[model samples]
Target: MTGYERYLPILLLVGSNIFMTFAWYGHLKYRSAPILTVIVVSWGIAFFEYILMVPANRIGATVYSAPQLKGMQEVITLLVFAGFSTWYLDQPLKWNHWAGFALIIVAAWLIFLE
Candidate 1:
């Protein structure tokens, strides 16, 4: 695969994760908002997540196995979530969080070895 084809899916996944992280957790900041309103807004934001995620997996399939793609997505999610929680939500990740994430990275690495 060309460099663009190889990397585009990862980049797309990253962007999608950003939207997803916001969709799921962005509401935490506005706890007083009606539950129905939060759900609707989160769904609206999730629409964009699907828009990117579907294509990311489709294109990614050309270069990586399904397991690899899923592993990549999981690792990406953690990386993105770590930043989102800390920067956007003002929730700093503790050492154990990093340790768990590191273990997940190891798992992803193992998946890629298959």
Candidate 2:
């Protein structure tokens, strides 16, 4: 597969995560939905998450070892969560947020190391 194809999973992973963040946290903004509805809605959105995640792992399998795929997924999740929290949720990013994300970014860089 091409390099882009290999990274397609990563892209979908981000998209899924963004949707997931919305499904879960967006409720704070939209409280009309009952708790049960929220849970069901999140689950519904999460279904697409597996769709992307499975393909991501499969395609990444050829280019990356299992450990790498898992590690990449973790890092991508955190980064996506950060952006989704700040932008979509309209949450102000505090110092703690930066510090936490910085650490995660450092960890991501370390994982990229052979």
Candidate 3:
């Protein structure tokens, strides 16, 4: 695969994670909204998440194993979530959270090892 094709999954994953993060956590800003309304709205956002996620997996599978794809996705999710939580939610991550995220990155590195 060309470099662009090889990295397509990562790009798609970034987009997917952005949507997923909002779908799963964006409602915190509107806590006063009705639960049913948030649920429906979250589902609507998640539809776009799946739209990017499914193709990322399908294309990535050609170059990466399922486990590698999952590991990549998890790492991407954490990175995206951290940014969202800090900037959007106004929540700072604690030291332990950074440490835990570092450990997950190590685990992701291990997944790439042959």
What lDDT does the true structure give each of the candidates?
0.96, 0.77, 0.96
- Candidate 3 has an lDDT of 0.96
Task: For residues 9-107, write the lDDT of model 3, one tens digit per residue.
Answer: 999999999999999999999999999999999999999999999999999999999999999999999999999999999998999999999999999
Error of 1 at 52 (Å): 0.5
On lDDT, the stronger of 1 and 2 is 1
- Name the weakest run of 10 consecutive residues (lDDT summed) in model 3: 1-10
Q: Count the backbone clashes (under 3 Å) in each candidate.
A: 0, 0, 0
The alpha-carbon deviation from the true structure for residue 30 of candidate 2, after best TM-score superposition, in angstroms, is 2.7
- Which residue pairs in model 2 clash with each other? none
lDDT score of residue 74 within candidate 2? 75
TM-score for all predictions?
0.97, 0.83, 0.97
In model 1, the worst 10-residue window by lDDT is 1-10
Residue 40, candidate 3: alpha-carbon lDDT: 99
Please give the distance, in angstroms, between residue 45's alpha carbon in candidate 3 and its true position after superposition.
0.2
